[model samples]
Structures are given as structure tokens and as C-alpha cells.
Target: MDFFTAQDNARRKTGRLVVLLVLAVLALIVVTTLAIAVAFYLMGDQSTAQADLSAQGMLSALSIELVFGVAIGVLAVVVLGGLFKRSQLGRGGRAVAEALGGREINLNTRDADERRILNVVEEMAIASGTPVPSVYVLEEESINAFAAGYQTNDAVIGITRGTIRNLNRDELQGVVAHEFSHILHGDMRLNMRLISILHGILIIGFLGGMLLRSMRFRRVGGGGKRDNSGAIILALGAALMVIGYAGTFFGNLIKSAVSRQREYLADASAVQFTRNPEGIGNALVKIGSHTLGSHLQATQAAEFSHLFFGQGVRQGFSQIMATHPPVKERIKRVMPDWDGRFEATWPKQPDETDAPDSLDSDERSAAGHRFGSGAEPGTQAAVLTAASAQTAIGSMGQPDQRHLAQARATLGALPEQIRTAAHEPYAARALMHALLLSEDKATRKHQLEVLQQAAQPDVYQALMDYGPDVLKLDVALRLPLIELALPALRSLSMPQAQHFRICMERLIEADGQVSLFEWTLYQLLLNNLSEQGSGPSSLKLNDLQRECQMLLTVLAAAGQDDPDEISAALNAAESELPFSLTAIEDISDMRALSLAVERLRRLKPLHKPALLLAMARCIEHSGRILPAEAELFRAMSDILDCPMPPLLSEEA
Candidate 1:
């Protein structure tokens, strides 16, 4: 699916999920109320059968207070359970990895398997114009991997040991691409919501299980207390057990309906991304033959089964509630000519010699031109050159084979020191410092002083040393350079990361006036490298007028030279939005602009494209975008997880 269609589907699915959740909650209330009334009926029975109360009267005897209490209690439990789970996951995708015993891989990792995955992840991130995501390795010897998080910046990739040891490089790339599909298509957000809701439903089962255990071995003392109270407790406990499992049943049903089809779509998207059906197709064939296949043994396997590359657990209930489509079905979709023979065995060790053929020289050179690498030396990419053209989606979340080739060349073009620095935490922090350093000699000296005071002495020295090289990097490479530094930034201890953020803030605002370039760099660091990784907020921002007006004002002011041009650009952008912007103004104050971006950040995916269009229009107000404007607009889009391809003249 295209960008808008994919976003539309996500929105519609959310509505469908809400409707389904409401139905599930109503089902719980009805079942719970009946169970309670049955307990009361059994308690009353033998002697006063029809003498006092009818059956309707018995259900009617279910008091209004008790009914309301049951309804409210169940609803509160579900809501609270969902909120608690969401909160726990809010710690970021790292929590998802930790939940299943996945260990974070270091950026400077020497281990071949670890290095390979990190490289693949980095290439994909750069190709898609996203921040490089952190990678984690699960110790289990199962051929499965998953991408998790609320959005792009905080996203993490998790894979099993078997996946590393068994799959060749091309197969691994296919698997990674599939996971990336989930991230780009807005699937992760939906998955997080599903996880929270299902976890909430699971609370009922857990509570019932605890009650059943609590009743074990209690003394059978007094006849009255044991007979009367024990009977009621027994009935209540049994009823809860039944209700809990029922909730689980519906929850899984919802997960199945929501999750199964997405797997197929991801598979197709992976092939589209890499332009090699065999890459992904062969991986699935191997999964079919491997002993572990994709089944994970983690206790929480069932919890995140939907997130995996394949079925992470054995199917039950006629495969009706399976989180992924069958392996055979998936492979056939990618390879229509397959004769259904699974690969008998996979290599025990990953082999570099057998990697899938990458781009040929012609393909590489062509990609270099499209990606700005093959252009004249020092000429930056026009990734967001036209404010208007860059704003409209080209392959917004979809990067084709050329992007893959470009990513490979891009990684290869990095200087040795920068590449090496990107692999270590302290050195990586130094690189970040250097990227934010001022070009003005006086300002640069002051920034260096702030870094020495706030960061480690060694890092401060390294930052100063890399100053020349960092300054020489082309504008187009800056985003990808910072993207490479992400995993290293993540490797720092929590305290260290916090200190880095403090150091960066001090360095950027130290001059008292934040330059547009400095602000963009600051936004990137703040959003991605913070102690709390960037995640979707719980707030819902639907009033697009106020938000778009504010955001467009900042964008308009940043990109346009003339006041009239700024107004015209803002008007053009808002015209595309689902809202009106009647009072567009030239907002030059950086603080006000930053606040506007922060406010607009919480908008759902459907509204963001409009804001993006407005920003592009504003930036192109001069009829053509300059390199500086292009980079700043790209940073704005990056913050919103809106990936913009390199802006070619023809794209306009």
C-alpha cells in the first residue's frame, strides 16, 4: 500500500479495535453478572425453590449496586491494566527486549554476528532517512526476530541467536527489512496498543489464578464458616477462573484479526524494499526446516508473538487465533513458483562468503547520483529542496532497491575515524559534540569550554580533535552520520546519557541565540538520544487548526525571506490541511517555534502529512530551496517520523 492508504488503514483499524474492545468489555460484564447471580442462586436453592422468587426475580435480585459495582469494577480493572502495561512499555522498545531476555549489542561489537546485524540496521535506517535503531540479541537458538517501539527513534531490533548463526547475510537483510516494514507502516504503534489491551485482559486471569492458589490448604475449622463462606468463595473463584479465560479468548481473537494479515503485508513490503523476493523467501523456507523454526521459549513469547518474523509459538484452537499466517502461505506469497519444498537444514555458522549478491557497479553509481553521493564533490543532496515537493509523499515510508544500494555506498564512504568513533560510546558522544559545535571561531571556543565542563575530559578532547573532520562532512551526510552514532549513544549508562544531554543543551544554547542549524541538531539529539527514548505520547491532538497554525508559523518563518512569501507559503500548506489557517504570521522567535513543534508532535499520523506539506510550502517560498533550508525541513520531518526521499528536480 502507498503512504496515505497505509495511514488510512491504520486509522480505520484503530476505530475497529476500539469497537471490538467495547464489545469485549460488554461481554465481560454480562458474563460476570451472570456468574455472580448463579453463585447466589446456588446458595439459595433447595428449600425455597419457587416459593419466594422466580428465575427473573433471581436475576433481578442481582442488586443495582452489585451490578453497577461489577460493571464499574471490571471496566476500571481493564482500563487500569491497559494503562499500567502501556506505562511499563513506555520505557521504550528496550523494555520489550528486556522482557524477553534480549541483551543490547554494543556498537563497537567485534563479534561477527552482532556486527552484521548492526551494519544491516544502520544501512536500512540511513536509506529510509530515519535514526539508526538499537539492536538486541536474544540468546535463544530460534530463527526469529522482531522490531518493537511506539515509533522510529525509540525502535529496537531483537533477534534470536539461531537467526544470527543460521541465516546468511541476504536472508538476514530480508528479515530486518520485514521488521522495518512494521516500523515504517505505523504497525508498531498499533501493536503496542494491542499489547496493552491484551495485558489488561490478562489481569483477570492472573487474579483468578492467584485466588485459586490462595484457597489451597486452608483449615476446615468451623462448620458454619467453612460451609457457608467457603461455598461462596469457591463459587466466586470458579466463576472468576471461567471469566478470566474468556477474556483471554476474546483478546487473542482481537490480536489474531489485527496481526495475522499484517505479516503478509510486511513480507511483501520487504521484497519491495530490497527488490529480491529470494532474500525473504529463502529465509522463510529455512524457518520451515529448522528445528526451532521461529518458536521462542521465553515465558512472554505469547505476549509478543505477533511481533516476530514468524509464528513465535505453536498454534492452538485450529490456528484461528494464530498471530502470524502459516509459513507456507507467507513463502508462497513472495515466491509464486515455489514447489513447497522447505530447505532441509541451515548452516550452523553465519558465512560471509555466501552473502547474497549486492549492487553491481552500474547500480551503485546510479544510486549514488539519486542519493547525492555521485554528484559533484561537496554538492549536498536536495533531500527536501522544494518545500512543496518535499512535503508531498514520494516513497515516504517506502524505500525501494535503489535506497538499499545508496545505503551501502553511503556507509562505505564514511571516513575511517568517523566510522570508528560511531562504534564506541565516548567517541560517539564526542562526534555528537563536534556536530553541534559552532562554525564561528569565537562561538566554537565557548562551546568547547561548555563541553569540557559538562562531558568527560577524554570526550571533550576527542570532540575538539574531530572538529575539522566534522566540519568537512557534506550537509547530506550529517543526518546519516548522527544516525550511525545512535547505538553508541545508547551504550552509555543511564547516568552517562543524562550527562550527555545536559552537555548538549549547554553547548547549543550557550550562545544565547540558537541558530537554525543548531536548533535542528538539538532537536535530533533531544528526540533520539535522551535517557527516555522518543515514544508516542498518550495525548490525542485532533484540533489541527491551532497546531498547524503554530507549526506553519515556525516553518514559514524559518524558510521564507519575505513576509508576504511566508504568508503565502503558510496559506498553501494550510490549504492542504483538514483545517483552516486564517491568521498565519511570521514567527521568528526560536523558543516560540520550538514550543509549536513540541505541541504538534503529538498529532496522529493522519494529520502529520498536512503539517509536513505546509512546512515544505513555506521552505519553498523563495521558489527554490537552499541546502540549509532543505536540511532544516528534513530535520522537522525526521522529528515527526515522516521520511522524505532525496528531492530531485523532477520530483518538484
Candidate 2:
């Protein structure tokens, strides 16, 4: 999907979520307010009868109590909003995940069949321009897998032992692709948000439980002779507690409804990415027939049941609240007229005999043979080219088994070290440096030291050699490398470490231009990095003037130039700063330049003028401004606080 389309979808969803939250808060207030009002009315009647209090005095107290309750409810929602933004609930869930010691997984420990699962995940991640998420193995023999994290960088993919042993490479790839889709499309963040909101709703219930326990302790300690006031306070606490619990239940229902739809979308996206139905279809069938049946043993699994690949909880009510669709329905969507059964029999113990050969002999034989067969070598080459393209879609393509076999054989040509480095950034860096090194040992050692000192030895080495590798690669090979590097590149602190990011950007543009993938990566990296710190140096009037002059020189050399376009671009960029562009021109000194740049750097992503300057640079890079540049310049002008110059006016 296009970036803007994806962004718009997220914005629309966010708007809906806001509305839902507001409605939920309003409902909560109404329910709690009514409960408190009832309690106040009852207490007022009792006070009037017991103490001969005036009706007016009792009514005034009840009115004050209602106002106080409403104020408290509003305060609670405001506090919850703050907590959601801070992601307190997600942090708590992660703590629970960590406490379960789920991070440790022996990826290298393999039964002959299980080893291929790792290989498939690596291949897909390399193809998709996403990091290979950390994979965990659940010892249970249930057929299931799950993706968890607040975002792509932190995401983890976990699978039951049964999935690895039973599924082939293609099936495993289908499942992983499905999980990766969730990571890519912003579902993980929403999932985390739901968890935090639910936690806030449940806090009142927990407090009520605490108060109830305290009251019981006091009554027991006092031999059941409690103060009448204490009894009244206890009743009030009990009522609040029950009402608070109702809020929690309502919140969970909403969370589950939203989660179920996201799960369906993720499933469809998985199919789209892999173009394989039977792979996921068979997986569902296996889960249905298996004895364990996709149930998780972890207690926290119930809380995050909706986030899993299948139902993690076994409760009947949980099935109604399930985040995922029924397995039968899921399988039907993927495979029409398919008999729902697990073809492979489950073993009482882990079986070694059923493992398939890692390398098929016939596939290897075909790999060693010539590229062409019969009917003219050129025609054979063309057919092979078409088959290779279709392999990207996996089993859904028209390619026969032989084509799949041929594609599998190509995997052997890649270095073992490169494959091993797929999920490990540190190891990936060492491998990259080794690949970059030439025959000169001394020069290589010096370069390695420089990389090591930079604290990104792997990425630095990879960047140094990527230019040469890009030239050597065909379209197929180049695509995988770009995908593989995305996760690794994300690990770096681009905003805080400006020099490192500059080096990366320079390398990506080394061939004198950036591709669509490179541009996407740049933007993604910038967005991620900007969250951590003050971003890259911002564009100021002096900086823009200098860049504009550089563009003018480049355009002039090409013999077709527009000074008006150049002036307009500079004016538009400078107008984005908080301070006036004209004011900076009046100062025209180092201090002014420094202050302007600093202010620009501090601007929010929407307001930043540097992006405008960058767009202008991109437009003028070909030695002339495109018509599109004017629209970008104008959009940026509207976001800036500063006024535009008359020389760069649209009429001009």
C-alpha cells in the first residue's frame, strides 16, 4: 500500500478510537453517577429519619455528593488518558511476559523438520524489508504462533513446538508472514493501547477489593463490634467496587470486538503477502485436530488472548470474546471444499523419524544443470525469468513443483554466515565486515577498528560494501538485501547520532539517486528516530540560501533554470520557522543562523521546515524544479508561523 493511504487509514482509525473512548467514558460517568446518586438518596432518607434533619439540608448534601462524584469521574478519565499515552498497561503486560521467561528460545535446536521453520522465517523477513522478529518456542505441542510487541522494533514471534515439527517451510513462512503483516500495518500499537485502557478501567475494581479486605480485617479484629459509620463506609466501598468492575467488563467487550476485526484483516494480509492458502489452511486444520488445540499455559495468555494467533484461553465465555475467528471458518476462507483434518498423526513423544531431508537430491541435481532446456535457449531463459517472478507469491502462483524446487536450490548459493546473521544484529555486523574486506589484511583491520569504534561495526561495514553489492545483484537478490537491512538499520539511533544517519543516507544515494524502497526506509527511520530525541539539523534562512544557491548553480549548468522557482522554494522553507525569515535576513550572522536552525529542529514533524528544504532539493536535483515542487512548498508555507516573502509570491 502507498504510504499516504496507510497513514490516512491509521488516522481514520485513530479518530474512531477517540470517539469510542469518549463514549465509553461518558457511559462510565453515567453509570457511576447514577449509582452514587442512589446511594446518596438512600443515605439522606436514613439521616432525615434518624436525626430529624431537614429535607432541604439532606437534599443539599446529596447535591454536593453528586457533584463531587462527577468531578472524580472526570478526573479519573483524564488520568487514564495520561496513563494510556505513557503506555503503563503495555509496560505491565511486558513485565508479565518477561516474568514468564519467554524470551529464551533455542533457535538452533532442531529436529530435522523443525530446522526448516527457522530458515523460512529468515527468508520471508529478508524479502519483506522488515527485521526478523525474535522467535520463541513454546514447549507445548499445540499448533499455534503469536506476534507480540508495541511496534516493529520490539516485536517477537513465538510458536508452539508442534508448529515447527509439523509444518513445512512454506507453511511456516505463511504463518510468519501473517504475523509480520500485523507488525507492518500498525495493529500492534493499537493492541497495546487496548491493554492500557482496560488496565485503567480495572484499577477501581482492584482498589475496591483492597478496601473490602481491610473492612473484613477490622470487623474480625474488633470482634464484630464495628462503628456504624465504618459499616456505612464499607457499604459505599462495596457499591463503588461493583460498579467499577462493571466498567472493566464493558471495556474488555469493546476491546475484544475491535481486536477480532484486526485479526481478520491480519489473516487476509498474510494471504496477500504469501499468496499461499494451503499453508495457512493446513495450519488451522492441524490446530483443530491436535490434542492441545492451540491453548496457552501462561496465565497472562487470557489477558492477551485476543492478540494471539488463536484462542489462548479455554473458557467458554472466552470463545465468545475470542480475538480470532473460528478455525473452521478461517480454513474455509483459505481453502474451499477442504476436508478439515490433520493429515499428519500426532506422536506420543517428539518423533525424529518423520523429518524431511533439508536438501532434496533432485532439486540439487537440477541446480547443477544448464539454465536452458529444449525449445530454444532464449525461450527457456524467458520462461525461467517468469517462473522466478511468480515464486515470490509462493504456492499461489502457477509454477509447478519443479519451479518451487528450483527456487529452493538457489538458497544454497547464499553464504551460510549471511543466513545465520538474519536475526542477530551483532553477528550480522561481523559478517558484513568480513564480506567487505579485501585481500589487504592491514587495510581491513584498520577499517574494522573504525567500525568497532563507531559502535555499529556491522552496519558500517555493510554500508561500505552495499554500493558494490548493489551493482553485482540482479533485481531479485537486491530486493532481499534491502529487506534484510531494514531491521538492522532500525537498531541505530539516527536522530541522536546524526553522523551515522548521514553516512547511511549518503550510501543509499551513492548511485546518484534513491529508489522507492530507499525513500520509504529513510522516512521510516526518520519517524522512529525522531521519537527518541531532537532530530537532524533543521533548515534555516542561511542554510536554505546556501542550498538554494547550490541548486541554482546545478540548474544553471544544465542550461534550463528558473530563479523564480529557486527564490520561491527558499522563501517557502524559511517561512516554516517559528521566527521570521525576514528577521533572520536582517540579522545575517552566525548567532542568527544557529538560533533559526535550533528552532527549526525543535518544530514538530508537521511544522518542520527541513522537510520542505529536502523536498525542494529532491526536485532541483535533476537540474530543474518539477511542477509538484510548488504544491509541496505551498503546503509547508501554511504550516509555518513566519510570513512569506513578496519576491517569492505565487503571483510572481
Candidate 3:
């Protein structure tokens, strides 16, 4: 399935989860109400209780109002608990990672293992055409990893130390690819929702335990009405404890039901991504053979179990509550010809220092190479032939081996010094400022002065040092450089990041107007730095005709210089839509386009495919996808949450 279909499926799964939660809560209410009725009946006078039991049914002691009250109370606890946990996770994947005691790895780490994993993650990010996510390393010895976020922009990749230590490059790459599938398929958002909803369900048990503990501190020795009240309190606490623990059992059952099939899909996607099933298959075999297996030692393991690449926690009910498929079965699905034995051990793998910088021989010989061997950075171009445009759309969220090779090539093309600068927090800030500097001498001088005065002294100096190299970077590499710098930029302190944004604004305005590149840089930068609010995504194209026109007008104006060509492109794109579009002459005011694109970002999942196709149609109208046009197109796709891999030139 493509990105849209996968997202739609995730939405449908969420609906199923809600239905299950309702059923679970309803069951809780019936049990709790019945328990309360029995407690009250038993607490009544001995003669009266006997008479009532004889005269009416067990439930007769409970009024309809009492049952309704119990249902409302249980529902309130569950819903409120879920909402509370959701709010607590407002920072998205980072919060989840931190909650599990995973430490964020510095992008500039010199540790060989850290660097290797970072390189793998960077390649995957570029291959999949998503921003480089912050990577966190758990202290656990278990071989497992996970991707978590409400959406792509704020997503984080986390793996245990054992994962990096045990798996070789290909195996690690396969594991990372599986996690990326979660990010691309919209599973992270669903996973977050599940975490929140399940927390609510488990709240009853937490409250019950707390009540039981509170009773331990209370004195209940007086033999009068007070003694009877103590008995009732103790009974209530015990009953709640039973009901609460039952909720835990049902919650895991819900998790297992929702997570199992997705693991199979992710495993298959991993194979499709690398075209090397043995990579992931071996990783799983290694996990099965290892004594620790994939079981996490973290206290929060069970709570976030479903988010794991493998089962992160020991299952209480085995397969019935297992969040992932059995390892041997998963291996068989990925490698149908597998030799079934969980290999006790494999030959010692190469150390990180001796690892190859590229994919294995077979993977490197993919049929359709994305770039020409002789083509240099900045000059290498990708064509968007009619066939290629459709291919690019289909490739969204489904990056292949060719795309991985292209990502490696792009990373290799960057100058060593520039790459280093991009990965350092202070230098990254300097590099971004340098990229914003104008070509015009006077404008550049003014921008430098603005930075010298407003930027941190060290950052200003770093800018001066890297300025020439940044100015000399390849046009195609410029965006990739920005992608590389994001993890470092995200490392900035809030106040420093705010200052960086202010300085960047001054530099962009120093040129008197926002150029297309400047707008792209600003939008892409800010979008990654900030959090986007989640919405229903129910809006259709018909709901925002004006906004759609504005977006197409901006894109047409950016890609075409001639008025006739602009008009033609707009009309072509509009043909794919239900309505006509008119070009805005003064497309200089990018804020209008930004607003329009923001509204379009909420386009329903299935509805997005057509809108994106319309966009591709407009950009490819000139019969060639220029580097700048390609950059703008990718930016638009990124904003819309439809990651478009780097366009491959037909000439290549």
C-alpha cells in the first residue's frame, strides 16, 4: 500500500481500537456495579440481607440510578486518564523515549557504534525522504528498537545498546527500515493513541492499589458503627483492586490484537526496502538465540511494548498477549527458504571501524540507478518524465534500494568539513545563517553584520569560518545539508533556538524580499523545529477551492517564468482537480502560500493522493524537473506529510 492507503488504514485501526475500548469499559462497569451491589447486600442487617436475598435477585439491591452512576464513574476515570497521559506526551516521541530511560545520542559523537547507527539512520531518512529524526539509545541489553511520534516531523528512532552491539550494518539497517515503516505508515500516531488509551484503562487498577495502601494507614479497631464503616471501606478497596487488575488483562489483549498484523507488514516492508530478507531474518535469529532475547529491563517496558521492533516485554499470556509475531514465523515469512535453526552464533562480524561504507555487492547492482556515476554534485539533475512522476508518487513511503544508494551518494558528495560543521550544534546554527546570506555583496555584508550583532559570538565566528564553504555548496546538496543539520539544530536550548530564528529572519529580510530559496529554507526549518497540532484531516478539496488555487498559483509561478507557461501549468494542474485555478501575480508574499499549504496539509488521507498528483503535474509541465523545482516540490510534499524521495533524472 502507498502512504495514503497506509494512513487511512491506521485511521481505521484507531476506530477499531475505540470500539474495543468501549467494550472493555462496558464490561468493567457491569462487573463493578455487580460487585458493589453484593458488597452493599452483605453489609446490610443479617435478617434483612437474608430476606432481601430470598425476595429478590442479587441485582435488586442496586437501583437503576446506582448502576448508571457506577458506569459514569468508570467511564470518567478511563477517559480522563487517557486524556491526561496524552497531554503528558505532548512533546511526542522524545517524551516516550525519555520515559523509557533512553538517552539522546549526540550527532557529533565520535564513538564508532554511535556513528555507525547515525549513518544508517541518516541514509534511511534520506532514502525515505523524511527529516533526520533524533535517535536515542536505551541502556537495555535487549536487541530491540522502535520509532515513535504523532507524525514524521517530530518522530524519534530509539534502539537498545544491545541492538547496536549485536547486529551488523545490514541487519541494523533492516531493523531501522522496519521502524521507518512505522513512521511512514502512520503507525506512530496510532501507537501513541494506544499508549494513552491503555493508560486510561489501567488507571482503575492504579486507583485501586492506592486505595488499598491508604487503608493500611487507617485505624479500624473500634467495635461499633465505625468498625462497620471500616469493613465497607476494606471491601470496596478489594473489589476495585480486582476490577482494576481485570482491566490490565483486557488492555494487553487489546494491544496484542492491534499490533500483531502490523508487525508482519513491517517485516515484509523491511525486506522490500532492502531487498535482503536475511538482514532482518538474521537479526531476529540472533535475538532468538541470545539469552536476553528482546525483553527490555526497563520498568516501562510493558507500557510501550507494542512500539518495539520485537516484543519488548515478556508476555503474561504468551501469544494471546504478545505484541509481535513469533520470531521463527516472522523469519519464515521474510525468508521462506530459511534453514529453521536459530543459529547459535554467526562468524564474528567486522568491527565498526572496518565496516563497508556502502551496501553489499548484490544490493549495489540494482537495475535502475538513480544517478550517473560521472555526474557531479549541483550539476546532476533528475528528470520527471510523465512515467517518472507517477512512479515518484507511488514511491512515497516506499523507498527502495536505488533510493538508499542515492542517499549514500548524496551524503558522500558533501565536503568533509561541511559535513562536520552540519553535525555540531553551534556550527549548525552558523551554517544555517551562512546559507541564508545573500549573493549580492552589499546584502551579504548587511546580513553578516546582523548576525555579528545578534548571534552568539562563537556562532558568528563559526559563520565567518564556514561562510565561504556554505556559499560554495552544490544547490542539490544545500537541502540535504539542511537535513543533516536538523538533529544538531534540535539540540539547541530553547532560548538559543529562538535567538537563532530571530537572526535568520533578519538575514532573510536583509535581501529586501524572501526569495523562493529563502522561503523554502525558512518554512522547512521552522516546520521541523515546531510541533504541528494533530487534526481530524477530514477536509476535502471542495472545502478549500481558494486555498488550492493559491497553492497551485505559487507552485506554477515558482516553476515557470513565462506567463503563458504559468497559465498552462495552472490549467493542467486544475484539470486534475474538480475546479479551475488562477495564478496570483504577486506570489512574492509567500505568507499567503504558506497559509494555503497549511490548510491543504489537513487534506484527508485518500484525498491527498489526487492533490499530490495535481502538484506533480504542475511541476513537471515543462517536461523537465529542474533542481530548484525539485527542491520546491519536495518541500511541498514534506509539508503535506507525503515524503517524496529525490527525483532521479531520466538522463542518468
Evaluate model 1: give its TM-score.
0.86
Candidate lDDT (C-alpha), each: 0.77, 0.50, 0.83
Per-residue lDDT of 583 in model 1: 51
lDDT of 3 by residue, 1-652 (tens): 8888999999899999999999999989987898788778767775676576652555767889989999999999999999999998998999999999999998778766778899999999988889999999998777899999887778999998888877889999999999999999988899999999999989998988998888876666557653666666687788888988788888998998998999999988888888889899999989988778899988898899999999888876568888898999999999889888875643233353435344444444332133332354345435556555667788888888877877887777666788888999889999998888887898889888877888889999999999988787666677788888998988888899889899989888876788877887888888888876636788998998988888888888887689999998888898789877887767887888788878888888999888888888898887777777777888888877788887765643
What C-alpha lDDT does candidate 2 achieve relative to the native structure?
A: 0.50
Q: What TM-score should be assigned to candidate 2?
A: 0.63
* Candidate 2 structure quality by residue, lDDT tens digits, 1-652: 4222332454456557667666766766665665565456545456453564455544444466676778586558646754854554343223334533454344454555446665665555443434445566666666777776664445667777777776666677678767766665556656666656666666656666777767765552243433344545566677778767776666667666677776666666667656777777777787787778888887567666666787777746666555677888888877888876655457345555346535565554553342222222112121222222112222221222333233343344333345445334444333333333333456545544555565454565554544243333222232234334334443445452465555445444344444333443344345333333334323344445443333223222222246554444444434333332321122223233333333443433333334444434434444433222322222222213111110111111
Superposing every Cα of model 2 onto the true structure, what RMSD results?
11.4
TM-score for each prediction? 0.86, 0.63, 0.93
How badly does each model clash, as a count of residue pairs?
1, 2, 2
Q: Which regions of candidate 3 are displaced past 4 Å? A: 46-57, 215-226, 345-378, 381-386
Two-way lDDT contest, 1 vs 2, winner: 1
